[model samples]
Target: MKVGLYFGTFNPVHIGHIIIANHLAENSELDQIWMVLTPHNPLKKKAGLLEDYHRLHMVHLATEKFEKIQASDIEFKLPQPNYTINTLVHLEEKFPKHEFSLIMGEDNLKGFHKWKNYEAILAHYHLYVYPRISESTIPEQFKDHPHIHKIEAPVIELSSTFIRNNIKEGKNIEPMLPEKVWEYIDHNLFYRK
Candidate 1:
């Protein structure tokens, strides 16, 4: 199977994430899109981040109905301070028959060169980038790279932080989240700090 790994902390999975993942799954040649839930991202601060399982459960809630998209807890089993390179290598070994690609936003592309063994990643796997509202330009070297495919997906500006903040302030973020996810958060009182 051709799978695109869409990695995220997914503190609280929302509609924007679902929209982008679904867009790639339906519009691109990818057979499946795995929403890999990361336990901890090296570049991000830990504050306000939900526990791994809570985040994973929300992802499951958000993607349960989508046949082409599924939630993965693959990173949770790996070592902490996870890096994309390590995860990619592990996935390749675990699923030799499957071709794995990356699903990322245009904003991430600007810092792609700084990732661990980024050159190796480019050499081994194709990157499918969706549009994002960002001011940074993609590096010159990656502009026309064969391994990088810029998908003309919709630009979703919504974010988990925005949803969390609104919920904390007693605002209705129901429309910003998937129905099941919204219910899960409402029941558990998540992100209402």
Candidate 2:
């Protein structure tokens, strides 16, 4: 089956993440979406990240109800400084039976050229991009990249960083996340030190 690899940190999966995955699964040709949780991104600071297992568990809890969506901890075992190209290459080798593609947001559109082995990725994989409200100023150079297609899924501006900060401050989080997601966060005391 053709699948979309929806890779992210998913430090604590929220309603927005689930909603987008469901939208793609329902509307797109993808059979399912695997939420590949990255343990560490080479380009970003690792200070605020929850443990890999915990993050995976959060994704597990958040996506429990969706048959077409799954949480993956594959990156936890892969070599560090995780890059998408390497992961895709590895998965293709391991699961030749399942064809895989990419799912991402528009914020990542401009930066795609800078990733390691970007050319190979563009040539090999089909990228399914959702419109991200935060990145309104994409450079003109990124306008016509090959293999990139914009999806019409409804967008949400909510972010995990904002949710994490709200939790740190002891603020109400129910409004920002789904009821089940809130329960999972509260049950695990995630982001509450």
Candidate 3:
């Protein structure tokens, strides 16, 4: 199986995530899209982040209906501050039959060169990048790289922060989330600071 790893904190899994995952799964050569729930991203601040299982549960809720997309907690079992390269290596060892690729936004591509062992990742796995509204240009080396595939997916400007902030301010963000995810968040009173 060819799988594309869509890594995210998914503080509260929203529709934008589903759209991108679905788009890649249906439009690309990937047979499956794994929504990898990162327990802690080295690049991000941990403040205001939900617990790992809560985030993972929200991801499950968001992706449960999709046939090609599924949620994963593979990183939760790995060491903290894990890099993409390490995860890829572990996945390859465990599931040797499956070819794994990366699913990232164009914004992330801007800093791809800074990642640990990025060259090794490029050599081993294909990167499926989707469009994001960002000012920075992708690195010169990756712009035309054969391994990096630029997908013409929709430009979804929505974010989990926006949803959390709106919910905290007593604004309705139900439409921005999957119906089940919204119910879970509402029932648990998540992100209501």
Candidate 4:
């Protein structure tokens, strides 16, 4: 099985996330697209992040309907400041039959070098990049890399930050997220700051 690992905090999975996952599963060579919910990203700030379990549940709600798309909390059991390379290594050990690949946005590529063992990631696994609306070009260094492939997945300008802000301001985010996810957030009073 060829699995595309879409690593995220999923701080609250939104439509944009589903869109990308669905696009990759349907249009790409990947058989499955797992939304790897990272409990922590070493290079990112954890200020506004919700509890790991809540974020994981929201992802579960958001992706429940898709058979090919799954919500994985594998990182939850891993060490803090979870590194992608470490997770990849663990995944390979656990799922020996699956070929794992990394799915990321072109915007992330700008800072790819900063990630731990990024070179190993590039050398060992395929990277499927979706273009962000604002990032018009791939970095010069990776423009011709055979392991990196650009995917023309439909881009939704909606962001989790935008949705979170709307919720904080008491705005309706029904259209921005899956119905179940919004209901989960509302019922649980999440992000009601």
Candidate 5:
């Protein structure tokens, strides 16, 4: 199976995330798109982050009905401060027969050089980059790299932070979130101060 690993904190799964995942699965060579929920991302701030299981559940709720998208807690059992290189290596070892590709946004590509073992990631696995509004251009050096491919997948400007801020401000978040995920947040009173 050729899988596209879409990694994120997914503090709360929003429609934008689901859209990107579906677009990649339908438009790319990937047969499956896994929403890899990171327990702790070293590069991001920890403040306001929901518990791992809560975030994981939100991803599950958002993607449950999608045939191609899956919510994964693969990083929960892995070491803290999860690194992409380590997770990719582990996945390769666990599923030798499956081909894994990294799915990310164009914004991430700007900081690609800062990631740990980025060269190895570039060499070993294919990178399928979706366009984002900001910093949409790929660096010159990687523009023609065989393993790196930029895909024009449909994406929304909506972000998890925007959703959270809307919720906190008592604005209707139904428009920004998947129905199931909004229901889960409403029922559980999640992200309330």
Candidate 6:
């Protein structure tokens, strides 16, 4: 099986996220897209992130109806400050039968060189980069990476931060998030000030 690892905190999974996953699954050669719930990302902001359990549950809710998508907590069991390269190594060892590829935004693709063991990652695994709102740009040196491919994602401007802010401000967010996920957030008081 060819699985695309879509890693993120996903404080609360939004419609935009669902769209991207579906778009990739339908368009790419991937058989499935795992929404890897990262407990703590080494490269992202943590100040506004909800608890990992909360995030994971929300992802599970959002993707419940889609067999092509999965809510993975692999990073939750790993040590703190998760690194992509290490996570890839672990997944490869654990699921030897399946081939794992990365699913990231084009913006992240430009910074691949800064990541730990990036050279090894490029050499060993395939990358499926989707376009973010930012311009899709790859550094010249990385243009020839053997196993890299860029994909065009669906047009959805909504982000997790925006949803969280709407909830905190007592604004309507039901339209922006998956119904199950919105219910979970409201029931648990997630992102409430």
Stretches of candidate 3 off by over 4 Å are 41-45
Best by lDDT: 3
For model 2, residues 114-165, the per-residue Cα lDDT tens digits are 9999878878888899989774555576567666777899888888998999
Model 4 residue-pair collision total: 0
Per-model lDDT: 0.91, 0.84, 0.92, 0.90, 0.89, 0.86
TM-score of 6: 0.92
Q: Which sections of candidate 4 miss by over 4 Å?
A: 41-45, 135-137
lDDT measured at residue 72 in model 5 versus the true structure, 0 to 100: 90
Q: Give the per-residue lDDT of model 1 (tens digit) for 1-193.
A: 9999999889888898999999989999899999999786566777789888888998998998999999999888888777899999999999999999999998899888899999999999999998889798999999999999999987888999999999999999899999999998999998888
Model 2: lDDT to the true structure: 0.84
Which parts of model 5 have CA positions greater than 4 angstroms off? 41-45
- Tell me the number of clashing residue pairs for each predicted model: 0, 0, 0, 0, 0, 0
Q: Better model by lDDT, 2 or 3?
A: 3
Cα RMSD (angstroms) for every candidate in the order listed: 1.6, 2.1, 1.6, 1.8, 1.8, 2.2
125 Cα displacement, candidate 4 (Å): 0.4
Off by over 4 Å in 2: 41-45, 139-142
lDDT of 5 by residue, 1-193 (tens): 9999999989898999999999988887899999999896556777779888899999998998999999998888798777899999999999999999999888888889889999999989999988888945677878889998889877679889988888888889798888988999999888776
* lDDT (tens digit, per residue) of candidate 3 on 1-193: 9999999888888999999999999999999999999896556777779888899988988888899999999998888788889899999999999999999999999888999999999998999999999897998999999999999998999998898889889999999999999999999998888
lDDT of 4 at 30: 98
Give residue 39's lDDT in candidate 4 (0 to 100): 82
Query: If scored against the real structure, what TM-score would every candidate get?
Result: 0.96, 0.91, 0.96, 0.94, 0.95, 0.92
lDDT tens digits, residues 41-102, model 4? 55677766898889999999999999999999899889886789999999999999999999
User: Which parts of model 1 are misplaced by more than 4 Å?
Assistant: 41-45
Between candidates 1 and 5, which one is better according to lDDT?
1
Total backbone clashes of candidate 2, pairs 3 or more residues apart or in separate chains: 0
